[model samples]
Target: MIPTVVWGTGNVGRAAIRAVDAHPKLQLAAVLVHQPAKVGRDAGELAGLDRSLGVSATDDVGAVLAAGHRAVVYAASGDVRPDEALADVVRAVRAGAVVVSPALYPLYDHRNAPAEFRDPVRAAVEEGGGSLFASGVDPGWGNDVLPLLVSGLGSVVDGIRCQEIFDYSTYEQEESVRYLVGMGQPMDYVPPMLIESVPTMVWGGQVRMMARALGVELDGIRETLERRPLESTVRTRTMGEFAAGTQGAVRFEVQGIVGGEPRIVIEHVTRIHPSCAPDWPVPPDGSGAHRVIVEGRPRIEVTVEASDEGENRSAGGNATAVGRLVGAIDWLVEAEPGLYDALDVPLRPAVGRLGRNQKEEERA
Candidate 1:
């Protein structure tokens, strides 16, 4: 079994613990934390597992890295702390621990990634003789892998579109929703996520990744946005009441225009309240789903609706991300040491993974 350490204990981090613990190929080495409150806690308890794994959580990242784990699942958020997260991941790789993380967005497709952000990570991999992989649920599989795979099913394809339609009220990340995404904020204020060329900076890589997967050269990337305000006061279980007329929902599209048209596109329809975008596309279950639509000869459309513990779609989606990264540990360890993304490494299915999700299994 590969010795694996999970960093962070938040949404994705907790899921990482569960994934690494359950995987037959991985051993729960240690969990790294940033909060003092989480230190010295049992890994299973922190991950909400059925029993303790006897591995304690520590905030000392250096000691954990120095302990010689084969792989590190870096779940720390890069939304607000990209630089810090980059440095941390580099330190892990330099310590000779193969890294798989969603924190570093720039390395999602390192080949076309900006030199400013990609060079440091590239250098770290070269010096450490370790590998790095960056991905997430949306920008990860929902964008690149799923689109290209769906396109193969159709005989002729004119355009490919990926959509993330969900309600953010259940997702309790206040800073991300309120500030980064501009949810529940005033319309006059421009959210940092949508500022000119920022969407392109974050999601444009996914567009390029998809284009490269489909073997097409894009003309250029483009962005179009729309905002809607809540008509009446609404309340959420996690977040408190949102006043009427504030920013209630946001819909945006980052298109990879080819041949003078938006051929390859990534669209997000997010609403603080489900009713905000009644007319916009939504999950048939009224929760959320990753959709891939191939507009062509077959006009194929596929939607994935998944959930984790007790119908927590947010947790379920993140679990899939954890599963994707953790499942690739052995593959990343044996492969040539370099930076990788979804296209570079295949997500191999674990033989015992099915038994772990037996409840969801029987439902099928």
Candidate 2:
């Protein structure tokens, strides 16, 4: 059996723990936490599992490494500390552990990522004779792999577009909602510089992955971010009240270019309340949906209505991505090592089946 260490005690970390707990070939050996308050607690209790797994949560990374685990799942913070987390992954790889991470920037924005972020991890993994793989849901499936799947139906291709529309009210992550919806920020808060260069930071890699897969050399990418004040108070499980007239809705559009011409456009919207913008197209379900459109010999469009469970139920897009990563770990471990994006991964029904069965078994 593969002994695994899970890093972080957050939403994705908890999900990873549950997934690792259920895998027949994997054992939850340890959990590493940065918070002093979480250290030395039962891993199961930390993950809301009433039963103990014989593993304890600790702030000691070295101790966990010394325990002789074969793999580590890095499900820590995805925002500001991603680079640091990647460094930790490199350390684990150097210590002879395969690493699977759901960090956002590394998996999608590899080409333009800072040397400090990418180089050390690459060097460490190579030197240690280990491998690292990163993936999530949006860039993983909706934009990256879905377009690749659609490409199978045609010979020539013109352009590709992917979109995700979801209600932010039900999402339980305050930081995610604030980040995506631009809440509690000035309308003029010129989005972070990284966002401007790479199309709003949320779906940059999705566009890049599609362009690369189709052999279309992109000249540049452009982004447009817009938001409006919320008309009424919005409530979420995490955030009780987003006061009326606050900056609570956001719409982001990214366009990919080839020789100064727009070839592909990807759009994403996160709203705290429903139908905030009537002019924009909304999914029929009002929950959340992913749509992909391919322009080629025979133009084809496919739309998937994801269930409001697992990651989709809360935490915005990150949760869904986390779920995808947890589900794919079984097959991903055996795949050849390299930088893999969503297009490189397969979405098999069996993975979902396994996840559901595991959850059911846990309850039993």
Candidate 3:
């Protein structure tokens, strides 16, 4: 069994702990936390498991590394000193442990990443004889892998676009709302300059990855950002006074090259409020709708209606991302060394079904 340590006690971290607990080939060795309040607490309890795994959360990084684990999952907030978090991962890797993270900034278009991080991280993993991989639902799977999969259906493809539309009122994380969707700003307030660069940051590698897969070089890339107010009061667990119409929406676009010319375009749109969708050419698919449009010799459009399993749509996406990550721990640990995105990671349908089985057993 692969002994694994998990960092953070937040939503994604807790979910990862639960996944480690149920994984057949993986064991929850230790839990790391930065918050003093959570230190020494049972990992199971933190994840609402109501059972102890004989492992407690600790704030000591060196002590956790010395515990003889082979892997660590870093699920903490990227906005909070990502460099420090990267250092922690590096330390774990130096101690001979592979690392997987869901942090946002690290995977934002590899071109924009500082060489200081890219080189050191790779060297650390190699020095320790371990590897590193990063992935999440949005840039990880939704935009990158999903589009690549859609392209498989056709031989000649002109362009590919992926869209994720859902109501953010149901979202509970303040950082997620503020950073990913640009919440708390006026409708007229344009998204931050960094927000406009997300497509290049998150999926820029996707453009490159696809370019390599399709044997084409991108001529140039383009991006745009826009926002509008909400039309109705929305309820959420975190905020009670969202007002009748107070929210913002943001969009990102990337056009890729073919034959030394621009031929493919990819777009990502996010809205924090209702009616914020109407202002855009393509309105929000409020029902957790995801669409992939392929324009080529054999034109095709595929739409998927994601399950509304949770109280709100945003929660459902979070849950899906968390669940999938947790379920894949066993397979992920065995993956070969070097950087890997979602496309590089294969999903084992049987492993996913195990999660479904566990959920069913819990409900029963």
The RMSD of every model to the true structure, in order and in angstroms, is 3.0, 3.5, 3.7
Model 3 lDDT per residue over 1-364, tens place:
6888888877668767876767666678889998999988999788877677778899998888887688787878665467787787677777777777777454534444568777777787687766666665552556566677788899888877766766565666776676445565555444443456655665566666666666776666666555556666555556444544455555656667666555555566665555666655443455455667878868778765544324455545655565566655666567766655555667566553444555335545
Decoy 2 TM-score against native: 0.84
Please give, for residues 1-364, the per-residue lDDT of candidate 1 as tens digits.
7999999998889999988877777888999998999999999899988787899999988788888899999998998898999899988888888899988777787898888778887788888887898986563788888789889998999999999888888775788889999987888989998898887877888899889888899999999999999999899988888889999988999999999999999999988888796899988888777889999999999988878766767677788878888888889999988889889988666766675553234435
**TM-score, ranked from best to worst:** 1, 2, 3
Candidate 1: deviation at residue 278, Å? 0.8
The candidate scoring highest on TM-score is: 1
| TM-score to native of every candidate shown | 0.96, 0.84, 0.83
Superposition error at 250 for model 1 (Å): 0.7
Give the C-alpha lDDT of model 1.
0.86
Worst 10 residues of 1 by lDDT: 355-364
Best by lDDT: 1
